[model samples]
Target chain A: MRLLIVEDEADLRVALTMSLEEDGYVIDSAEDGEEGLYKAMNWDYDVIILDIMMPKMDGWDVLAELRKEKNTPVLILTARGAIDDRVKGLDLGSDDFLVKPFDMAELSARLRALIRRAAGKTSTVLTYRGLQLDTAKKTVSVDAIAVQLTALEYALVQFLLMHQDTVVSRTDLYEHLFNEDDDSLSNVLDVHVCNARRKLGGTYIKTRRGLGYTIGD
Target chain B: MNKYRSIRWQLMAWQRFLLAAVLITLLSLHYHLRRKSEIAEVDASLQSALMSVMPAVAPMMGRGGPPPYEPNSNAPPPRYEPDEENNPLIIAETYLEEIESNGYYVTSWDTEKGLMLSVGAVPASASLGNYELIVETPHFLTLNGNRELVVTHNTDLIIVIGRPLTDVNLALKKTRYQLLLVGSLVFLIGHIGGGIIIRRTLQPIREISQTAEEIARGDHSRRIELAAAPEELASLAQTLNNSFNHLDSALEAQIRFSADASHELRTPIAVIMAQTQAALKRDRSTEEYKTILQACLRAGIRMRTMADSLLELTRISGNGSVLNMALTNLSEVISSAVEEATQLSENHPLSFQTLENSRPVQIDPERIHQVLMNLISNAVKHNPDGCTIRISQKETAEWAILEIADEGTGIPVDALPHIFERFYRVDESRSRESGGSGLGLSIVKSIIETHGGTIEAASIPGQGTTFTIQLPLNPASDR
Candidate 1:
């Protein structure tokens, strides 16, 4: 999963980024609504966690402006747990709403749910041939035997598994596998993929020439 | 924003209604009574004149007297005589003198004497009691140019006496016009007087409302001055002043809460996030993992406590959480809270003085217990190891007071007033070490207030901090 966090509170923004990155989601953040809006216009993200109160502009205006061009899934966060703010955010095309002081687990679950729904994948369990990935349990089984994978390895394999029959480009793999917290301008995709393939078996993923990787029979 | 008519306007309307009803009724009564009395005086004089000539003519009529004073237009009219008392024509002559002297035109008639006529100011064509009415009274005569009063009574002869009504009608008309002018003047004066009175009466209320609006808009220092008003208005002003005082304090508290919420909650989030991110860049050894987890655990604990405190605040301020009042023993509540505190304490010893007596107080047991627990927890958290905390109680004439003294690093004098404010920490560094969210005192204050009690704190920079809480022994309902 890939996500963007647009929050005025720098501490909360950083904290949410680190926690979600630990859960294996590539996260990018903007300090204010203006920067957030600009980024949303240029980049594609699976889910956007938007903060309502921000400088330069507000989340409502950003949502309205973004909705004028795109239909990305948006999650709104507000300091005030007031229901009125929730109703307004939902009305303005927000997919989910969370108040401040949220737990890490809840944040991770909501992000996964938003990303899954956006990809039109209803079931939490994804299967390709004899390989099975349970997103809810975050476990993998190949031919009825358990397979152990690191958080990053699991996320990379799950992305390929979700795009079972399509070619996922290397650029797409890097965007989904890493977040801003990682040192930039480095190619770590090859190492993570070698590890994922080693654990899930080489036959489970097929690499397309000049494209990326996918999981198929 | 409210559309109701002003009290000033209502008062003015009522005054006008009362003045109009009373003034009009009294003026009409005076006019009718005065008119009747003046007409009666005129009739009495005319009847007396006929009586005066009766004794002289009473015997002459029985001795076969001829018809007297034939006003034959042929005998040029005779002049009146003042001393002609023995003459039967004296009555006619007397009226004739009045006519010539005072412009009192008169006409007399009798059964034996045919109609003896004079100048016809009224034409005398109709009998007595016939007069055209003008302005609700027959005191005016514009038609036939006859303004006179005709008075008739039978004595030895049928004497019909008439005095010209012009003067009476003019006098009564003058009175009517004077009355109208005076009544209007009174109404005008009353209108202005009532307006002034209403404005003066409602002036204080306007000032109170203006002050209230200012306070509502966040000018909490604004106040109503009651000393300048009269006793009645002063009471109303005093009530408003009291209400404004409470509202102003509540506004101040709300502002403090919001400020603390944003500023205090960010620090913990920053610490945890930075530590976690720095630790996650690469694989780490077990010792490094233990350090990172320990730091994260401290920050996480602070956030959890802060969230719990925030929830308690919301519950106290919100309408959904109402106090469930029940009779509770103070000793039991104190003991239960202390027992819980002992389990959570990090080696600090707590001492509770055994009460000489126990009283059942009307209170929400759970809320009171929460208050005790918060105070005890704060005591346990702030104090160093081996530092002692003493909890004791006393009874005043109207209150039961609880005293909790901590031998910890006391708060500064400047921060004492804000100790009970949400997320207010005297020493940020020290509180972070102890995982304090600075919301403990605020929760304690809220719970104490919900039980209709007051909590006060006194502390020196280094000696210690003592919290004195006074709960009413008799509930407000009992009082």
Candidate 2:
């Protein structure tokens, strides 16, 4: 999954990016509300972490503007513990909120939940035929046998299984699994797909010629 | 206690008490004075009756010869000699009859012969002593059947003349009744009227209290209606309104300060927590561990600096007891402060200018030094290296002025006024990296103010920024 972090504090922003990036997610960051809003409207991020206080514009204005154009899942990150701030953020169309000095584990877990809920998957586990993918554990298994997969391969498999029976185009897969900083000319996507097929079994994955990949009966 | 709860009620109670007392006193005075004058008139009439009867009775007492008798001045003489039936006694009886016809009871008692003559049927209960008592002064008495009487005595003839006081007493009784009725009516009317007037007069105060209650309940926009207030209460209302205005602004500032302080502290806390959490997630190289620990240390230092700034700000602004004042040379203090500040920032070019005739000013030297250090360091930090930071002092008749001007990138026009606000920064991202806790200017302003001084900032938004501080020369002496 891809995420956007919009925060003003430099050290906090860098720490959040580094920590969240380690949780098997592609991250894009903006230093202020204006840049954050611009990126949010232009990208297909699974979730956006917003900060309330910022320069150029505030998080509220950015969220209001972004809500007018997109339904991207938003989790507000604020230093204010005031209930009024929480209520206001939620009323302004934020999917979740986390106060500052929050545990990274909780933040990562909430992001995952938001992404899953946005994809219309109620459970943490996604299944395709006899293969099981546990999103929380970040692991995949074929017929009760665990298969070790790289972070990128696991992301690709999860995306395909989330859209089971539908062909996910290469462009959609790349947008979801990689951030803007990733090289577009790289053949990493095909290599990850081939590895997932070998590990999870060949019958569970299928690729539409001249289109994309799918997981179906 | 409940009755006095209302100011109008209390005012009415006191006023009605005074009114009732005044009315009763006047009414009693009128009643007593009227009764007194009526008794005097009755006594005068009794004395006059005595004067008239005395001459006629004297002739009857003499009886030396047939007393010259006249029956109407123009009538013919008596045809026969004065008979026993028509002697001087008959003449005396005629005079007595005249006095009796005028509501006077006349009686003559011969002390020598023990003879007594009475007319107008004086009540038996009238106290006419048998002894040879001669009281010439008139006096009052109540005869039987409660007839008020006035009586007087003559010494020579021992004649007593008495008059019933029925008419005088009746008139006085009526007047007393009327005075009581009128007094009661006046008291009732005055109290009712007074109550209404008092309530109306205090209506503005009630409104002011109601408005104050609403404001206390958090409706900050409400104010006392100055135009509608009574003249007596307008000043009070205005003063109360001024206090409310000040308190409202003070509370708003406190709330904003709390929010800013929390935000300032939370960022560093978040940085440390995030870095530590990320570092402990898995085993990492020694270099990675070193990097994470360094970031946490930086965050910790920032938090500590911010905490110290907040404490200093609170101590300076909270009260005046923290200031240790003394008489000292203003230029010397400025020189020492500049020397210390120069040592703190060697890259910045600092220049100090002082008045030639610098006088000793009353100030807290340590606090003044702190203020100078803060302002100088702020100039150094906000400006680029090698930018000129000038410190100058000037003296007026009653003021010692200090100006710290910087020739660096000035603050933006919008952020200039808020530069001294707690936790405010011109550029948040840049200032955080430069390790500015944002409370430097705030603490400086507090220290200056605590020393009975004023501070103002002027910025041209890219030209430069200048901070001018004015300290009173004798702050501790007169005040």
Candidate 3:
């Protein structure tokens, strides 16, 4: 899964990025609302974590501008505990809200729920042709047998499994595979695809020439 | 027990007291004047009669010329029966009748002959005084059970004269009744009409007091609705309303300040909690754990800094501008502030430089140093690591001015005026991200003002910002 955190607090931003990255999410972040808005509009993210108070602009303006052009799911984060502030953030088309000083586990669960709901799947586990990806446990299985896969390989498979029938372009795969801080120009995606094919019996992973990767029977 | 007296009641009581006193004085004066004039008229009638009768009767009794009527000595006989044609009885009878007809009575005596003659009704009991003009004025006496006023003359014979005084008494009684009726009506009218006028004039004050009471009961919205009140009470209502508005705004400010301070604290707390959770997620190398600990420490320090700044700001507000004065070297204070800021800062190197010497100023040194630290720290917090902040000084004859200028992303022009106000953030996100409590400039301003100084901000967007502070060399002693 992929996520974007738009927060201005340097320490909180860095800490959240590290935590979500460890939870098997490719997380990108911006230090202020303007940069956050630009990146959010430019990329296809599974979920965007937005802060209501930010420099240059605020999450409301970002959400309003983004809703005009995109349907990316957004989860709001704020320090304000006032119900009015929370309601205002949600009323501006954010998908969910979490007050600051929240538990990392709770944030992780909410993000997973948002991503699953966005993918049109009602469960944390997605299956295709006897292959299952347990999103919460970060594990995969083939025909009732667990397949030990690297974190990147697991992420690639889960992304393919969630989309299932749609043709995911190289750009979309590359964009979701790594965050803004990673060296996306490298062959990390190709190597991860090679490793996933070698592990998944090499036939279920199919690539269309001049298109991107896909998963089908 | 409390005495619950309305303003109208007190007013009416005072008005009634003053009216009754005035009417009593005027009615008594009128009664005395009427009686005095009536007595004088009767005396004049009696005197004219005595003058005519003394001359004519003396010739008829043959005791000629002003001598026979000496009241204490001998006199002519009344039996001589002055000539019917020449006697004074016949000569003065018609003249005396004229005075007598207007309610006078006449009597005369001959001392040597020991005889008396009189006309008109006599009193059932009356005492006559010896005839002398210098002795007594006329007085009212009872005659035939009727009141009369009599006078005397003694040039040739004892002569006593009188007029009935019954009309004077009846006039006084009628006047008393008329005055009593008119005075009661006037009092009644004044009581009701004046009471209404007073209440109308004071209606604004009554409304204001009622509104104030309602406000005290926690409805801050109520106000006096007096439109056509008198000028003095109108101004009173305005002043009271103004104070209520000020109090309401002060309460609003208090609420906003707390909300803002809590907002500044939450992000750092979130960072600390997230970092701790991440570290304990799984086994990690010593280096990674150290890095997590460092992150936690930085977040904790940020929270502490914000908390401290908020506390300082509130303390200054509570204490107002009361300074603990001390005579101190201004340059040394600036030098120490620069040293402390440079020494304590790890990420950003903030520098302060001064250009001129200063006489020792009367100020609270610790507080002024705190103000200097706040200004420099604010600069360091906002700008990048390499940005240089310059502190310079100049002086007029009476004031010492210090300028803090920064080479960084400057504030916008519109934000300059409110930069020193409490909880006023030019950029809310940046202020919170930089770990500011939004009270730094306000604290600096308050401390400067405590030293009897003024502070202002000047900024150019994308270039730099400058803060100028002017402190008096000598604070006002009278304050």
What is the i-RMS of every prediction?
7.3, 1.2, 1.6
Sort order, lDDT high to low:
2, 3, 1
- Candidate 3: which stretches are off by over 4 Å? A14-26, A55-57, A80-92, A101-217, B1-8, B31-174, B210-229, B241-249, B272-298, B318-322, B327-360, B376-392, B404-438, B459-466, B473-479
Model 2: CA > 4 A from native = A30-44, A55-72, A80-97, A103-106, A120-123, A137-148, A169-175, A178-188, B2-10, B63-155, B272-297, B460-463, B474-479
Give each prediction's DockQ, rounded to 2 decimals. 0.04, 0.70, 0.51
- Alpha carbon lDDT at B18, candidate 2: 97
Question: Candidate 1 vs candidate 2: which has greater TM-score?
Answer: 2
Tell me candidate 2's interface RMSD.
1.2
- Quote the positional error of residue B344 for candidate 1 in Å: 3.4
CAPRI quality band, candidate 3: medium
| Candidate 2 similarity to native, TM-score | 0.81
Off by over 4 Å in 1: A1-217, B1-4, B53-164, B200-242, B268-304, B317-321, B345-353, B387-418, B452-469
Report the error of model 1 at residue A163, Å: 53
Q: Residue by residue across A78-193, what tens digits does model 3's lDDT show? A: 88779998888788888999999899999999999998998899999888887888999988888878999987788899899889987888788878878777776656677788
